[model samples]
Target: MKKKQQEMQQQQELQQQQQQQELQQQQQELRQRDLQQQEKQQRLFFSSSYFISFAAAVRWLPPLAFGEGKNLTAAAAAAAAAAAAAAVAAAAAAAAAAAAGVAACFFLRKEGEG
Candidate 1:
């Protein structure tokens, strides 16, 4: 009877150990998933921030340049005109860049889903 009891106790202990191991594995997997989610979020935030900064620079730089040129002599008129033209070009480029960034994000998302 004592031997039987010892054997049963050992079996119970083994089962408990296996359950603990399974729980640990599950916790590890959950942690890894969380980390991956955080990394993805960080990437998205940085990309958006970069896009915002680029857009703002494109929008404001031309006017700032033109304003500074006004402080100069008669050449300031020509410089201001050139700055305005450059601003238009910059706006077009910013639009193109935004489009490309959006396309890239979509492509990456598709790849991740696959």
Candidate 2:
């Protein structure tokens, strides 16, 4: 009789342990789902904000390009173009000076050798 009672007690303990494990598993799943939902909401908010800013920029882009609105981008582009032109001119001048130096050396060397 004692053996039977001991077996029944063991079975009850096993069932309780299984129930506890199942409850823990469910809680973990719920937590994961909550975290996923929060992440999705954050992503949506970030993209929406970016979209709003992009829309605003596009709204002014055409006017700016056509020179009808603020000349911020246009002025910047003009300045950049001017700087690039100056750089090209300087490079050409340096190249010409280098060629002249090489030619003078060749002529002087030929005169000395001859």
Which candidate has the highest lDDT of all?
2
Which residue pairs come into collision in candidate 1?
none
The TM-score that candidate 1 achieves is: 0.52
- Give per-residue CA lDDT, model 1, range 1-114, as digits (tens): 999999999999999999989986886687577557655765665566556545544554665667765534544454555556556656665675677568657855775586
Q: How many residue pairs clash in each candidate?
A: 0, 0
Write down the TM-score for model 2: 0.60
Sliding window of 10 residues with minimal summed lDDT for model 2: 49-58
TM-scores of all predicted structures: 0.52, 0.60
List, residue by residue over 48-102, the lDDT tens digit for candidate 2.
6556545545555666677775667765565565556555655655575577568
| Cα distance off (Å), candidate 2, residue 84 | 32
Top model number, TM-score: 2
lDDT (Cα) of model 2 = 0.66
